[model samples]
Structure formats: C-alpha cells, structure tokens
Target chain A: MSTRKQEFLAGARNTFPLLLGAFPFGLIYGALAVTSGLSVGAAMAMSAFVFAGSAQFIAVGLVAAHAPVLIIILTTLIVNLRHMLYSATLLPYLKKLPQTWRIPLAFGLTDETFAVAIHRFRKNDSSRFKHWYQFGSSLAMYLNWQLWCFLGLVLGDRIPDASGWGLDVAMPITFIGMLIPFVKNIPTVVCVLTAGAVSLLTLGMPYKLGIIVAAFMGILAGFITEQTGKKIQVEIQV
Target chain B: MTANEWLMILGMMGVTFGIRYFLLALADRIRMPSPVEVSLQYIPPAVLIAITLPAVILPHGEWHFSFTNPYLVAAVIAAGCGLLTKNLLATIACGLAAFFAYQILLSS
Candidate 1:
C-alpha cells in the first residue's frame, strides 16, 4: 500500500474509538432533535451541514426552547469559537495545502478529528500527504455522524426515553481520557483547575457561554503560570 | 423543515465554516500575535477541561460534587486510570465500569 493509504487507514483506525463514543451522542441528537420539534429532514440537515456535535446538540436545545434564530446562531458561534484556535494551530501544517483540500478538511474538522489528526501532524514524519490522514478521519466522522443520525431518526421513537439512557456519558469519559494525559505539569494543572472552577461558576450563563469564558480563563491561567515559573527561574539564577 | 429552520441551519453552517476557515485560509499571509501563538498550546487542555469538568461534576445539570454522584466517581476513577496507564482505552473502560457500578450501587 502507498504511504498515503497507510496514513489514511491509520487515521481511521485511531479515530475508531472516538467514533464509538460518538455513536450514542449522534443517536441522542437525532432522537431529541425530532422530539424537540425539528422535522426529520431538518434534523438530518443540521447533522449534515452543522457538523459540530456539541454545537448541534446545543442548537437543538435552543430550538426546543424557542430561542430566536439570532441567539441560536450566536450561541453556535461562541460554542464553536474553539475551532478557530484549532484552525490556527493546524495552519502551520496545512497552510501549504490547496483550498480544495483545506475546505473539505475544514468541514470535517470536529473535536474527534482534531484530536486524531493533530497527533499525526505533530509527528516528525516525511510523508507529504499527511493531509490524507486528516481526510480519512474527517470522512469517517462525517459518514459516521450521518449514519447514526439517520438510525436515530428512524429508531428514535422505538428506543423509548432514549435521552435518559446516559449513553452520552461516554463523551465526557472520553474527554477525561483525552485530557488526563495533558495535566502533567504545574501550568497545565493550573489551566485545568481554573477552567473547571470557572466553568462551574459560570454554568448558568446562557447559550453555554460559560464554556468559552472558562476556556479563556484556563488559557490565561496557564500562560501566567508559565510566565511566573520563568520569572522564578530567573530570580533563582540571579 | 420550514423555511425558517433551513435558514437557521444555513446560518449555523456559514458561521461554523467561516470561523474554521478564516485562519486556515489566511495562515500563510498572516502571522499570529506572539501571545496568541504562545497560548495556542493551552487550547486543547483548557477547552477539553472546560467542556468535561462541568458535565462530569454536574451530570444532571445540577451540582453533585459528592461521591454519591456516579459521574464524579467515574471521572475520579477514570482520571486515576488514565494517569497511571496513560492509555485511552483503559481510562474509558475504567470510567464506564465505575460509572455503571456506581449507578447500580446508588440505585440499589
């Protein structure tokens, strides 16, 4: 097999665990979207077009709340603002690629894809087609999302109180798994602690604005901790 | 779907794509500020914690920080497993097992 093929398969294989985690989430989104008043077509369309899982879930909740269109849109913007950072971090590796590749890759970019692809991109590999790995992950996520969403739409009613099943807990667990490895240092510990505290304090913020606020607070805390650590090192050296 | 819902979905699509595309499209032409670039390293950890912390602690959208909260228990167990093993599979498996076990214990 070609190197591209290897990268692609590797991407898919790595993301498979995440796909399993998202399965119930996609199903819950579909079932709840319909039960919350979205038509079958619209629910599927949202899954297809607005592919961000968390954002789509929040948007559906807002829809059920009868929130104004502008609020829903605004909420989505804030909730997904993290993706801006994602694109920025990815820019270094992907900047040289053509728009055709970047566009689809960007469309397929999700928390899961970002998680899988960034590792490969950060690797010291000689493969020029690392983008293919991202492509494989993105395509897998997109297709996986659509398939589960459709199944949920079809079998949603049959599942009976599907939203109460707690399958969504898989996502948070997976996130914990992803995040634990990052809490190795003082700065990262500060970052995670601050983010957790701030999110809890701001939990009542509308449209889940608390998430953005907490994320920034965490980043700021981490940056300060790092800077302070450097300053202490300088003082000790003096 | 109604025209209004379609409009909302389109609006959502546009905003989501625009945010993701903005930086990737202009990456070569533009240089991020030093602070923004430096802080980028913290984005993954910060955002993931921000998203998951509340969900685990407040599984029902209500405060439940005690050991009685299955989500909290599971998360603690998962964190331990993750730190010790540095393995995703072990973390998730341990977490779910703890979660189900806690659920059964609490309900019983």
Candidate 2:
C-alpha cells in the first residue's frame, strides 16, 4: 500500500533520530573547519562537495597542518573505504535499477542512509519504487549535513571545543540501537564481541586503521564460528 | 577559493564518490564468491561494533574503563535501556541524558 511519496516520507521520517545524531557532527565540522584556517567559503564548499562528515573533519585538520593535497585525498580514500562495504551490502537491493536512478542514490549514500535504507530493503514488501525510500534517506542526510555545516560556519568561534561537547556520543548510541537486532544469533554475538575486543586492543593504529582491522577480525571470527556451529549440528544429527 | 583549496575539496569529492559507487556500478560485472557472500551479512554489525565499542569504552581514545568515564557509564545504561525497550528513541534519550548527567556529576 506504499506509494513513492509515502515510501520517501517514511524513509525521511525514520531517519529523524539519525539526523539529530549527525547534527553536532556536521556543526562541529563546519565550525572547526573555519576556525582551523579554511575560509568560510572553502569550508562550506567542502561540505557541499565532499559531504562525508568524518573525512571532511579530518581533511580540515590536515589542511590546518599544511598537509599536501595528495595526502588529504589519500586519507579520504582510506577513511571512506567503509562506504564500499555499505555499497556492496546494498547492491543486491539496488542492482536492478538504471544508471539514472543508481547515480543519485549512490551519491547520497552515507552511514546513516545505509543503516536506515538497509532495514527497509530487508523488509518484506511489494512496492515498485523502493529505491525512492533510499532516495529519501540519502537526501535527508545530505540536506541535514549541509544545514548543520552552514550553522557551524555562521557560529564560528562562538562554539569553541565543539568536539569536547560530547555530542559525538550520538554516533555510538544510535549505532548501539541499530546493532541490537543484528545480535540475534550466536555468530553475530561472537562477531560483536570479537570486534569490540580487537578495537580496544588495536586502538593505536593510525588513520583509523584499527577500525578496518577489527572489522576483518570480527568477520573472520564470525565466519569460523558459523562453520564450526554447522559442523557440530551435522555431527549431532548423525 | 584558492586553486589549492579547490583542489583539495574536489579531490576528496572524487575519491569518496568513486569508492561509494564502485561496487554499485559493477553489481552485474562482479559477483562475490559464495563464502564472501555469506560473510557479507556480518559486515554491518562487525563494523558498527568496531566503531561504537571503542568510542564508548575508550571515550578519550585511551583505556579508562572505570566509573569515572561518563561515556562508558552512559553507554552501559543506554544498552540496558535498549535491550529492555527495544526502542531506538528510548535508547538515544537515555544514553544522552545519562552522558550529560554523569559529566556534570564528575566535574562538580
């Protein structure tokens, strides 16, 4: 019973909390980028063009440190490597569409968008325009990110120590909520715990390499556990 | 904006887009082997935990797993809330409130 408009609105509506979660992140990026030496126009343009929150923040810091353009772009690639996982994960749901539809949808993908859109795609439905749902989530994230960036820029210097404000807590909190449903099986439980432990152990890796390392460790652990679990079941049945 | 500034931002845009679109663009051309395909479901939770656990348990990017850490205390409370309520809104509300309250208490 979902039309395109309804589907899109549902995506935006469900994305409301995450929008709040990202608010301070974008605001801090914009405010901090300006305070760090980038001109206001350049900062805004970065948000408009790059649109990746964490990368933009790191780029701002590197620019302040006078890092070369090649280094900045390289760092952007490594940091955003996570998005490729998201894209790959969602490909099954989106591959049937044309380039015209896929192009904008891909451009709008973010962690929040992927997190939100994935759930809808997983849902049992018969709607012909489910991509519109992702379109909604992606557009919401994009607009929300830009608006917060603008505010942070306008409020530059007025908001000092934006990072110290503890608003980043939203990311973990929202993520925890999203993660609970995924912990419904033994392999998933192992995955979460293994990932958690490795993250703390590898906390010192540069450029957020620990995240990538820990994620791989968790996935490996989960895969092994699942295989062993299946073997045990087969033996028990025999 | 200066040419260098423009170069930096545009380069970032290109790379970010390229990475995000790489897999989607090649969905038909590239198919992951079955084992890798089975492992795909684990990616979201693993990556999310890898990101969140460190942020919560090691809020300051160092090991301080004690009652003094407001982020840890808030996150634990929030997890409990999430488990009991199974509601995203409630979880975030409790987590943020707990974080701010614990921060104020520790400072004063």
DockQ of each: 0.75, 0.78
On TM-score, the candidate that comes out on top is 2
Point to the candidate with the largest lDDT.
Answer: 1
How far off is model 2, as Cα RMSD? Answer: 1.5
Tens-place lDDT per residue, model 2, B1-108, is 899999988899999999999888988788788888888888889988988988888777677789998888888988899889887778888888999999999999
Would you estimate the TM-scores of all the predictions? 0.94, 0.95
- Model 2 stretches with alpha carbons more than 4 Å out: none
lDDT of 1 by residue, B1-108 (tens): 899999999999999999888888887897878887787778888888888989988888888889888888898998889999988778888988988888888899
Best by DockQ: 2
Interface RMSD of candidate number 2: 1.3
